[model samples]
Target: MAKRRFGRVRQLSSGRWQARYAGPDNVDRPAPQTFDRKKDAETWLVQKEAEILAGDWLDPDAGKIVFLEYARSWIEERPNLRPRTVELYDYLFRLHLKPTFGARALADIKDAHVRRWRKDLLDNGVSAVTTAKAYRLLKAIFNTAVDDLLVRRNPCRIKGAGQEKSPERPVLTVAQVYALADAIEPRFRALVLLGTFGSLRWGELTGLRRRDVDLDAGTVRVERQLIRITGQGLVFTEPKSAAGKRTVVFPELIAQDLRAHIKDFAQDGDDGLIFVGPDDGPLWNSNFNRRFWGKALTDAGLAKIHFHDLRHTGNTLAANAGASIRELMDRMGHSSTRAAMIYQHGSHERQREVADRLDSLARGQLKSGSGTQRARKPKKAE
Candidate 1:
């Protein structure tokens, strides 16, 4: 490392005098800096030397590239993402990210600027979770720029970066489930029943075909989901993930109800949609939720919950009935066990029953009166 001393200028063989500062990376790299006079070199070198020693020396050239230009390039390069996902990314960029650092060059973005942005988001009443998501998007964008050599480092690496806790969803009780079922119109009753018992999502429920239900086998095949896109509107697509394509079994009673439902309401063709509008076309999510679900829940005299809560209620009931974590995951089509565990919090009665069974097995009470304990019966028979 070059010793820190002002006015110590070196004249190269080319007769150009330049000031040099050793980088913290433990190498004597040139600063690409030039000076017209020895005094100028000394002043520049002294200020740089102090900053380097303070462990805060950053090259200013990095902060020169504007963030908006890089963000546009980033969005354009990703063509394979789903339309809904792309729309969300674009929304986050325009509403949150771009407005903050749109004009700032990539090289000029600093840790302090990122910190202030996070604070401003909180001050503006944006939820911590949304802010965190936006932060991650920004981090990903800048990290790509770093790989491309557009910037020295990502400024998003500072601590307290992302959102923390996700909001909790309320689970419904068995009585509330029945009330919700009874309150809806008879035409949409099966929809509520399938959602509550089978744990089908809104898209999955609306995407069902007559052939997907096997009444004798008591199973429903989940093959596709309805997705609402911004520009193209509603379309049926394959399940979001492989795990989402699954078979769910229901009780024989529910299966019987489904059979009757088809015989009376559903069309004869196998390709006919199981749940459709009065004109036999695809069901619109907004119209169904507004006309059927909202009024049903209100009449049931229960808390206002979204249609998606029916799926949660199903998972909760299964968990309370002693369903294993893996079984619940498979039924819910959850790609991971983490979310399924949240719905597995059952009542104290179930927990106590499990504890008592475990205690009996551990204490050898199960073998106390077995056939091996027979006494004198063989002698009497002889």
Candidate 2:
């Protein structure tokens, strides 16, 4: 019963070894539970001592911080995050995470809790994609807690819980694209053309100015996007990534249409907005989606088509036009290959074209061989 150098271990009446250590606060604390053997208890004490020496030791009681408090603090401390990204994280917390684990202590969240939360989300009619996003957000927050030594390990270990398996979106054909452009109001026709041909995003298209489009040069410069942050209204910020800042060549097929749109619809001055609503202000996706997008689709007889599908159409067309992965990435303003690769998948029609070409080549070779065999048959024994 002599005092040890760092801590002490003693056998309880039940023959289990118990370890106690003096924490950084100078208060003696017992291990959460008893160990089966004295060796195990001694090993645990050694780790605790090492953690103290390395200044990585966190008071066990500190892990009891409420989940919402810690998560909010974690988000607020990231001043470098983009405004839109911060907005999304905030939304996810409010909509998905807060109702479930907000009141729970950070250390009280277990693997079963996370698993049940995910299952409940799915059972409550949440789409699998949304559930996956929520799971990923939770996993990321818990990972940071682990690094801070707030927890021993992350409990979001459910396999494939963080992946989003979105179904393939429908891509508009060339004729459908033109029909949609024609069906929309004359002032907004150019928006459809630019979205479908240039593969521009909603924000990028709305962020355009008179000077951004060059009819003579057949190019459109994407320098910035207009993002509507919560309570901040519409603010102009640079592209989400370096690749997003690009110059896309507008197809000559839409040159006349774009020229007419600029002359008739674009605001006055070089910095004037190119695409605006009926009130001549910047176009907001919410208003557009509510007012015009559905009408345009109905007018064109295109069912189950979303406005963003126009961009998908453009990317698919670009990939079918023999664009390599890097070219597709540059055109789509994606910093990674995964999205560009998805667009680069050979279209059914393009795959059919490949098969047809191979069949034609085989037929031509067979015909040539037959002619050679007839020609070398000693002139038909004449």
Candidate 3:
């Protein structure tokens, strides 16, 4: 076989040519693949020589590190991630990413591998929302790998694979919200009302303290949130974003109930938890869902719903009440306007607008009606 200045090629027993060269680090490296012809092998060596001379060569052996090790280190190296976010990353790695890619080398992961893994997850009935989160995580890990030069390019190139097409969450009407609040145990009535009208997240509402709430002023300060992370149990942490730290001025309609809750259920100290379970401890979601939420759904004749839907309902109410995008973002504690836009630009509400206009066009032919209606049951709470 012929020799080259950059690399050498030798014919294999099967008549294929293998290329070997000294990399810029002076380490002898082999071409990743054997070539069908000596010329092909020499061509690869030439390209590697050019890359080395141009300072664009990446050490192939670096990518031999297993994906699991790199991914774990990636999560660990990140600074200032919320504990719940770290927990979620761990969860996704364990359940979704680890099973398929953990043992594989970073260099071995390909776009096809990601596509097949995503397809298998969907086929196995894993939720799209969950799959999307996992996919995004995988993509992010690979992104860092590219930046670190572990791999030449990101393997996660599927378009729209990272976007979650979450179903529209159910929102409770004012009457329904009030009925559900009343149907729950008396101690949690104010908790439920605050969740709806104030758009308080589960973590924020459960983490409230006597010092954080001013019943007379009808404002609740959101300085912190309580999150339950696996292994660590309940942890009190700052809000997810800076916008989450803002205070909310709630409707005066619920002031009476707030005072009653404070008097009947709250502790005297400033640091006292605003909401608690029967054990008079930190309010746990599992206990509340099993003991209160399930029963409240039955008594109020409402269908199954997640607790976060209360915040969803509150956001919708605020949007219907003409809250601006910034106002909604502040109330919902969102870092961006994308989530707020979902509530403001709902297709169902737009369809109603079209129907109402069409109804007006036909008003001459039909009898006049009550026009529009709004629920007024929240004020009726005893």
Candidate 4:
């Protein structure tokens, strides 16, 4: 056979065309199957050469691994992933990704399949936010696969499909915050107040120690959080990011409430838990929400508002108090300004005040102009 430019296409003894080429590793590998036509074999060699040139060539057999196995390994081998994050990935895989792509080979999954799966999820009443999460996880998994040369290209190509559209929650006024604080139990009044004023998350609030709260300094040092993992009770771990470990100063209002809470409810020693159950043991979010939070909401007449919204309320209040973007990010324990921007947006009342001020300015200018014209009038030219 004549020497070809990229690879040789030779006729096998069985009368089929076979393509062979030396891969990037300098290994001589042949086509998996023989082509009936010489042109088809030549085209296959052309693609192989193009892949090699582009540094995207992967062994055909490498991507044959089942997606379920590969995805599980990916999640397990992720470095520095938190326990809660790992749990969420596992759940999302099992509930959303596994059933659709579990048995399929990694290479066989394509953009069309992803689009179909997302459509089916929405058709079956799955929330868009949840579907977005699953899509993002799948994208991450495939991204790893691409990096490992297990797949040539990622299939998650739907634009904006991986971005979650979360609905804005209601931000409580300062008065409403106090109302909820008064409605909750004495021991938990500080929880409501801090969640709104200090912008502390549930895990941070539950994880606080007496030593972490400095009444003298009027600041709380957030260092750790209490996260509940499945098959494990509650584990205290450092905050997820370096930015999460912050020192947030509380106003005198929050300080006074904290003092009362410490005197009436917090544990005795500095090492003791600050927020606990009725028995002074560590409080769980589930227990608080089920046993206490729901009743407090009803009593405060703020039904349908989630407890997490209290943190949002606090961030909004801080923004209203002229907290800058960086200050909001620091106070909210967020590593990025994206979340801070969301919290720093103008309130409806603030927007209304702007319009009201503009109207007053326009009316004042009109009255001044009319008076000047009247004063300039010369007795009807008499």
| RMSD in Å for all candidates | 8.6, 4.6, 8.7, 4.2
Per-residue CA lDDT of model 2 for 285-343, tens digit only, reads 89988889889888999996777888999999998988899998988898999998897
Candidate 2: misplaced stretches above 4 Å?
A: 1-6, 9-18, 34-58, 361-382
Q: What are the TM-scores, per candidate, against the unseen true structure?
A: 0.77, 0.88, 0.89, 0.87
Worst 10 residues of 1 by lDDT: 370-379
- Which 10 consecutive positions of candidate 2 have the poorest summed lDDT? 370-379
Q: Write one digit per residue (lDDT tens) for candidate 3, span 4-102.
A: 567788999998999999987899988989999988998898888899888888999999999999999999999999888898999999999999999
Candidate 4 segments whose C-alpha is farther than 4 A from its true place:
1-37, 354-382
lDDT of each: 0.81, 0.91, 0.90, 0.90
User: What TM-score, to 2 decimals, does candidate 2 have?
Assistant: 0.88
Q: Count of backbone clashes for each model?
A: 9, 0, 0, 0
Query: Mind giving the per-residue lDDT tens digits that candidate 1 earns over 1-382?
Result: 6855533567667666677766665455454677666677677778777878886666555456688988988987986776667888898899999988999899878889999998999899988888888998899898888777677688997576675676776778878887887888776778888888999998998888889999888899999988788888888888877899999997665776688677777766887778877777788888887777788888999888888988987888889887889999999998899978886777677789888889776556435655444344455664
Error of 3 at 280 (Å): 1.9
Candidate 2, residue 146: the lDDT equals: 94
Candidate 3 ranges with C-alpha deviation above 4 Å: 1-3, 12-14, 346-382
Instruction: At residue 4, give the lDDT of candidate 3.
Output: 56
Which scores greater on lDDT, model 1 or model 4? 4
Clashing pairs in 2: none
